[model samples]
Structure formats: structure tokens, C-alpha cells
Target: MSDNSSLLRVSNASLLPPLVDWTPPTFTPAAQARVAATMVLFVFAAISNLALLISVSRGRGRRLASHLRPLILSLASADLMMTFVVMPLDMVWNVTVQWYAGDGLCKLLCFLKLFAMQTSAFILVVISLDRHHAILRPLDSLNAHRRNRRMLLTAWILSALIASPQLFIFRTVKAESEDFTQCVTHGSFHERWQETAYNMFHFVTLYVIPLLVMSCCYTCILIEINRQLHKSQEGESLRRSGTDMIPKARMKTLKMTVIIVMSFVVCWTPYYLLGIWYWFQPDMVKVTPEYIHHLLFVFGNLNTCCDPVIYGLFTPSFRADLARCCRCRPPADSPRSLDRLSARHESDPPKAT
Candidate 1:
């Protein structure tokens, strides 16, 4: 989310056992700005992610490659989780400036927040890997469905497992002296380094590892593409086919996904970098303008809003679906008629390419 927990730590230093003596953070202008920006992003993300999921499951999406459909569907599903879980949680937490939901919800919401974020990153990695396979090993496309399924299953399970520690680490700690309560990992660790270590672990897993994997996958894809281009240049027949090594559909998909990954990196890198700095040097928080962190967080949330836009830009089917929805236009033919037409078309003689 917006790292409310980190903000809580900033306000309350020297964590003690049951009750940490500290002042509660107020809903300052910075927090207000974050909440406002988050509300805008949330509305866009909710509508767009839902539209993408629907488009992927029905109509033209049904005609998408069997292997690719799952990847896109999984990506949209993860973005939806971020939409519903992280956006609302960050907005509400910023507004209230304290935990009113008590301990049970405190733990559960924290877990869900991490789970959503981790799931989103993991799914992107899966998509990158899928693109790699599609480009590098075209013949293995037959087994792609099975391979993608296994990878998706692993991504989900790994996300849950990585985020499981949140349940034990977070709780509602009341600052009796200030007569305020906040949900944080204040008393979870015995030493300061332990808390830093925990945060760094999540930071690496959530950002660093996924970024590296996506970069490597794309790099290899680019090198392979260049090699194919060179080979095509050497052969007159290859020139006639126009880089037939990679199919147009597959290349288009790869470009769309690369942009998506770029969006992720561009949006989240600043927020995470600030977080890393604060984790290592808590003193920096005092000198840093509070609005900087809040702005960075809003920038990070932009990634959720970007995915569907990128997909629509690449896929004509998605744009057509949106246009159809806006115009309230129904298909000229019913589903049964469409099916019969499709069958009749299939029975006709093949046309020359």
C-alpha cells in the first residue's frame, strides 16, 4: 500500500512491548493529497481492470491463444486485487491516521495487502517468462498451456507463502499515553536490525528479483530477435517472408507486455527507493519533505491504472469491446447464428495468403 506501517514507525520510535508511547500522526495535507490521488487511481483501476477481465473472458478473448489467455487473465486478476485491496486500504488508512478495525482486521488486511502486491509482481514475471518461451521456442507452443498453468500455480502459492508472515508480525498496539491505537509491527521484533532485515527481504523479493528476471527475459528476446534479423538479411528467401522467424501476433504481444513491465518498473521504483533509504536511515525521514513520500506512493499506484490502458492500446479486440459498451451496440447476429456462420466459414475453401 502506502507503507502506513512505515509511517507509523516514523511517528513512534523506540518500540516497546504492549504499548508504544508516541503521538498519533494526524491527517496532514500530505496525507490528504495521497488520499485524493489514491481515490482517482482507484476509480480508474477498478473500472479498467474489470473491463480487461471481462474482455479477456468473453467474445474475442475466447479466440486468444490458449496459453496467452491465462497469462493475461491472471495479470488482470492480480491488478484487480491491487485495485480492490491496496487502493482502499491505503486511502482509508491515510484518512483515519490510526487503526479502528482492531487486531484481527489489522493482521488480515496487512496480509492481503502484501499478498496482492506480491501476486501482481509474480504474475508479471510469469508473463515475461511466457513471452520468452513464445519467442525462443515456438515449437514448444503445444506444451505452453501446461507449462503456464504450473507457473501460474507456483506464482500464487509463492505469494501467499511470502505474505503469510504478516499475520504474525502485525497487530493493534495502543499508545495509551496518547490514547490512540495503530496497527503496526511495533513490538514484533526484539531488535531494530531484525525489523530492517525483515523489510529488506520483502523489498528484494517484491521489486529487485522480479525486475531482474523481467530484464533478463527481455534482453534475451531482443538478442534473439537481432540474430534472426541478421540471418534473414543474409537469405533472399528469408527477406521475402519478412522475418518469419517470429510471428506478427506473437511480436505484438511481446511489445505490449514489455511496455507493461516498463510501467511497473517506472511507477514503483521511486517509492521503493525512498523506502529503502528510510529503512537504512530513519533520520532521513525527519529531513525529507513529507509530501515527497506521499507523492511517490501515488506514483506507484499509477501502475495498476496503466496495465489495462497498455492492453487496450495493443489489442484491437479490447478497444472494440470498449467501443461496443459505450455505444450500447449488440451484435447484429445472435450467438447461435454466429456459431453457425463460423462453422459455415470453416467449411468454405481456404483462401490464399
Candidate 2:
């Protein structure tokens, strides 16, 4: 009886459970579909952004307004960052189901992910404001280059500043029970409310503020344009004098930017709203299917693939640029092509007379 009791004590000690329990994340069918969708979005965004960047840097896009080039470049740069940073991070995180990289990479990548998102939102705001200035105060166009430079600088700075918190909040947490680690914000906030507050702050700044500013700017622009049209219609003498109250080129650019903004809102609103619902009702995670969030995230990434397509649709030069690139021709050296591109650019806007 004494020997049996000794054996039982040793077995009980050996079978003691870990302090913290962890269940290893499974790669479900929904996760698999997400990875596949993410890969497709990444490829399309990368190619489209690279093409748009090349078109603006060396191709006929040189003919675009000096003030406008920076906006397009900044947009493309932000989207590329999303493609290279966010999409890959998401794919790897889902596939590995745990943190393979060390603590430092975890924080840095989270910072970059937030930074890219902020930059994308802020740059769109900047573009809307620029359009507002261009339409309402055309006489101030000479200062647009300096004005746009200042705005772009501020956008980048603000994005970096806002995203800096990720450096401290995100870290690699080990689950001793499963002997696995994950990059998460598990213990960053002492209270649950603190984490909710932090997320709400980001959500407001990232989506709500930008959406409001853009909507206001575009509304004012439309009102001004309508007033101008009404004035022109009523005044036959002004029409006969060959005065264009609004530049046709500016209008085309405005239309393109508006479409880009709409795409951003439409693609992201559902995802963001769902996130808010989940944050407020944590139990929704158990009640809701995982594929719902996965699909929403995939849909949000679709916005990155929309911008370049919108630009190409509005700009005739982009079509020519695409053709030249596809044919593997020297875009800059073709005088005939340059002339044709020049003609198309000028012809896109109507003459006042």
C-alpha cells in the first residue's frame, strides 16, 4: 500500500496542467480562402501601383500639372506599402497561426501596417482639399505646388506619429501550455475598456474623420461648379466672350478623384462597421461565422486595386502608357508617340471657344 501511494503521487505531479491554457489555432477552410484571396489582391495591387508609379515618374504623366503629380505618387506609394507590408503580414500570420518572427519584428510590422493605412486615408483627404482649392479659388493656382508640398509633408508626419503607438502596444506573447507564441496585444491594456478605447480612437481617426472631410470638400466643390454653370447659362455675353468658368482638365481630375474616394468608402465601410460590432460585443465572435470577417477584410483590400484603374479610365495618357509598356517600347524616345500623347492630353479637355 505504501509503494502504490508513492507511485500515485509521482503520476499526479507529472500530469499537472500548465498555468495558462492555449489551443493552437487551426487553419480552417475560411482561413485558406482568405490567404488565396489576399494573394490575388496583393499581385494586382503591386502591378497596378508599380505601373501607375512608372507612368507618373517617366512616362507621359510628366505632362500632368506639377501640383497633381505628388498626390498621385503619394497614393501609389501608400497602396504599395499596403501590398508589401499589410497583405504579406496577414497571409503569413494566418498560415503560421503563431508568431514565427521575434518580438522586434512583431512591433515594427504592426507599426508599419497602421502607418500604411493612415497614410492612405490622410493622402486622400489631402487630395480632396486640393481639389477644393483648385475649383473654388482657381486664381490661387500659382501657389498650388507649394501648398500641396506642405500638405503632403504634414500627411506623412501625422501618419507616422499616429501609428507610433503600435511600437509599444504590440508584442510577442508566448502560450506556455501549447509552447507557441503569437503577436498580439493581449496584455498591453490593463483593463478591457482601455483596449476598446484605443481601437475606437484609431477607428475614428482612420475612417470617420477622413470620410467627413472628403464629403464636405466634395459637396462644396459640386455646389460651386453648379453655381458656375448656372451663371454661364444665364450670361450669353460671358459665353460668347470665350471664358471658361471652370477648366475642363480640372473637372476630369475631380471626377477621377471622386471615384477613388467612393471606392475607398464603399470597400472599407462594411469591414469597419463589423469591427466596431465585434469590439463592442465580444461574444459576436462566437456567434458570427469567421468567414464573414475574412471576407470583409478581403473586400477592403480590393480598394488598393481600384485606384490605378480609376486613374487610367480618366487619363488618356495612361492608356498609351499601358500600350507602350505592353509592347516593350522605349516610352520616352518615341517622338511620334509623344506627339500623339500630347495631343490626347490637350484634347481631353474642351476649349472654351
Candidate 3:
């Protein structure tokens, strides 16, 4: 009787099928909209960034870039990298509806995403510092361009280092009891604070510190410009001899600085704020965050679109070059402004020791 019972139990167990938390594999309209929106954003970002790169890299645009070669190149490169390296991975994730690339690629994707963003932030900070140097401390310090290039290289290396931790802590796991995989930070419960800690760290590093640095630099730049303009105005001969052009140039640069910083804050603040809120109140997960997430990401990438416009706004030389590229004839009557801009670019790159 014992042997028969054991056989029956074994047969009954064998008759049961394996368990799988499967859901209907139908594509929802919501998912389709998300993918479509993301695709459009990616295409726009890629084109805008590529145009900025081309403008700064070749032909007449190259003349304008020569004055600030390292920063211009670094800025364009950072944005271009996002459109290439990061956007494609994001698009794939949206379309697949699963993290099917396994753990290794998931970590890599997380790393690259963080690296691109952090590097871009770092580049913005450096650009502000470069502008400060060019304006307030106008003398060349031997190999200034070479030093700026080194700074750009260092910023990239540091960004990678900063993002490296994500690879170890983030992983691919099945969502709850679902059949699909999720790439997310591994959970812990020492104080149930892992998510908050990571989110805070990222927010502070990528957003807060860079913003502070840029803010301080631009403030000082404005003060210096005001003082210099006051002194130049006190001299009547300086105005007649076109020496006032220095102050005008400084004012133009300050305008661009203000616009870029404001645009950066606008584009990035919502995303980081939402991330912090989610991490701090994990119980609020029931709240509909999909639309919020989509909106923030789309705006975050709008910065890439805005950079080219910022360049053209403050730099007439760049406007002329951009016009050439677009095959839009610049005003036949605006030759004087364009010539002055060209003259400024050539004379501006080098300074007496």
C-alpha cells in the first residue's frame, strides 16, 4: 500500500504543468503611443545635435568654434553621444516591452545612460568656466587650448567613473510574478532606503553641483562686465575708436549664458524632482506616473534642440554660417555685422601674454 501511494503521488505531480505568470501578449494603444512619442523625440534630438556638431566642426562655422574649440567640441560631442548611444537603447526598451537583453547588457545600458547625462552636465559646467576665463581673465596662459582639451578628456573619464557603480547595483529581474524582465536597482531593506539613497546621490551629483558652479561663474562674469563697461564709458575716446565693442561682446556672451542656464534648469528640473518623489514615497506607486515620465523625458531632450538656437542667438558669425548651411541667404544689407563678427572671431582666439 505504501509503494502504491508513493507511485500515485509521483504521477499526480508529473501530471501538473509548470507555473508561469503569463499575461496576454497584446500591444496596448498606450504602449504604442509611448513608443511613437519616444521615436519622434529621438529623431529630433539626433538631427538637432548633428547640425550643431556640423556647424561647429566645418566651413565658416569652424571659425566661430576655433575660439572655444574644446568646449564647443565637448558640448556637441556630449549631445551627439546621447542621440547615438543612449537613444537607440531607450527605443529598443520601449518597443520590446521586456528586458530580454539579459543582465550584462542591461547593466551596460544603465551605465551608458548615466555616463552620457553626467558628462553632458560636466561639459556645461566647464563651458561656463571657459567663458569666465575668456572674459574676466583675458590673457592667454601659454597652452590654454591644450589645457581646455585636457579638462574635456578628464570630464569624460570622471563621468564614466561616477556611473560605474550602477553596473554592480542594478540588475535584470522578473517583474513581481510576471513573465517579463525588468532592469532596475536591486532592492534591499537595511532601512528600506536603497532607492532613496541612489536617487539622492544621482540628483546631487548630476544636477545640484553643476548648477551651483555655473551659477557662481555667471554671476561673477556679470559683475566683471558691468565694472568694465562703466570704466570704458568714462573714456570718450574709447567709444569713438570702437573700443566699446569689448563691452558689447561681453554683454552678448552674458545673454547667451543666461539663456543656456535657464533652459538647462527648465528642461532637467522636473525629471529629477519626479525621481526623488518616487524614491522617497515608494508607496505612491499607484499614482499614474507614465504620462509624467513621458513628459519629463521629452522636455529633458528639448535642451538638445535648444543648444543650436542659443549659439545662433548670441553669435552673428554662427548665424551667418548656419544660414549658409541651410542655404538661406543672409540679409544682403547685414554685411557690416557679419564682417565685424568674422573679425572678432579671428582676433579673439589668441591673446597677449
C-alpha local distance difference test of each model: 0.79, 0.77, 0.63
Residues 1-353, model 1: lDDT tens digits: 22533373334332444454555578899889889999999999999989989988985655576677788899999999999998998889888888899899999999999999999999999999988887777667778889999999999999999999999988787776787887777777778788888888999889999999999999999998888777668773344444455555666678888999999999999989998887778778778888888888889889999999998877766766777889966445333221233223212322223
Candidate 2 Cα errors over 4 Å, as ranges: 1-19, 240-244, 328-353
Query: Worst ten-residue run, lDDT, model 1?
Result: 337-346
Quote model 2's TM-score: 0.87
lDDT of 2 at 268: 88
Which one wins by TM-score: 1 or 3? Answer: 1
CA error at residue 48 for candidate 1, angstroms = 0.5
Model 1 TM-score, 2 decimals:
0.89
User: Which ranges of candidate 1 are over 4 A from the true structure?
Assistant: 1-21, 328-353
Between prediction 1 and prediction 3, which has the larger lDDT?
1
Candidate 3: pairs in clash: none
Tens digits of per-residue lDDT for model 3 on 1-353?
Answer: 00111011111111122224535233445446656766787787777667767766774456542446557667878887777766676567656756688899878877888898899888888878766776666665334577678778889999999898867766665644455665655342234454456557778888999999999998888787677567667773244323344434544555676787788889988877766655555444357444556566657767776776786666665666667778998745453232345336423543321
Better of 1 and 2 by TM-score: 1
Q: What is the lDDT of residue 20 in candidate 2?
A: 67
Question: Best TM-score goes to which candidate?
Answer: 1
* TM-score of each model, in listed order: 0.89, 0.87, 0.80
